[model samples]
Target: MENLAKKVRSKKLSTRVDLTAMVSVSFLLIIFFMVTIELAKPKAMVLDSPDHGCCDCPSYPDYGENRSITVMLDENDKLIYYMGLLESPIIAPKEIKYGKDGIRRELLKRKNSLLKYSSKSLKPESIIVIIKPSKKSNYGNLVDILDEMKIAEIETYAVVPEFTPEETKLLAAN
Candidate 1:
């Protein structure tokens, strides 16, 4: 019998790994998160005031004293408010606290009264607020009062920095 020779064979294994799919998946995840995220934006408040002696300034109609409310901001977070003219005010100037129960309540009450009165007549009317911040009053106080005006929804308002002599005395006394 002839001797049979068996041939020995060696097997080769792959040394490389497929990383293209993994890289593609990682990039897809990164892109998805970037597209879905939202960036922060700056917030701003709208201020409406009359232009100072501008030749092309639009003329605004004069508002009545009956529909006016003057608010004075003092130091130590004290607030004073009055209605109509200071000389002959429909509502006398008085110190009031700040917040929903304080200035806001007073504003709403006066606004409703004026609305009722105007409703009887044929002309449309709204409350006009005059914000006067005293020298001793801080900027935060001014911001708070402005916020109150917004809360009370008094559309027509002005920020008058200068104070009258009587107003100065009134604030000094308070």
Candidate 2:
């Protein structure tokens, strides 16, 4: 009876030993997986500009390919208040003041034009308002323009840097 009890205790010890090896292997696998995991990288959009010695001009895309509206901010950071499609003649600021009401009215006019052109197609959720502020422009002006764009429902937009392609290329080359 003493020998039989000893044998039973031995069996229990063997089971416990087997569980220790499995737990150790599981911990090693968790550490290996954590070390081998790759972190996500940030994404950014690249803008193509002209090479060296090129004139300072915004990259003009093919006409009517994509509907875009350009709003120029002067040295004072005030809006030029133009009401026209990209690459088309810009209406002078003297004709329209650079106020919130004026911007809202112009946006509505553009929306009306798009509706007339694509009556069967789905209405655009937002208009692409490209802002190009002068180098000497105030930062507050840019913020104001963004706020105005949001209020006018023309929130989908891009900001063109004041430096031209040639300028950027020169800086890069130097």
Global lDDT of each model?
Answer: 0.87, 0.58
- Per-residue CA lDDT of model 1 for 118-173, tens digit only, reads 88777668898999988888988988888888898988889999999998888888
What is model 1's C-alpha RMSD? Answer: 6.5
lDDT of 1 at 55: 67
Residue pairs of candidate 2 with colliding backbone atoms: none
State the lDDT at 12 in candidate 1: 88
Candidate RMSDs in Å, in order, are 6.5, 11.5
Q: TM-scores for all candidates?
A: 0.70, 0.47
Q: How high is the lDDT of residue 47 in model 1?
A: 75
- RMSD (Cα, Å) of model 2: 11.5
Top-scoring candidate (TM-score): 1
Candidate 1 TM-score, true structure as reference: 0.70
- Give the Å error, residue 37, model 2: 34
Taking the tens digit of each residue's C-alpha lDDT, what string does model 2 give over 1-174?
888777744334443345888899999999878866733345443434445547765453433423556666655444554435323445432223455567667876876676576677564333566777767668777777777776776645667866556333333342
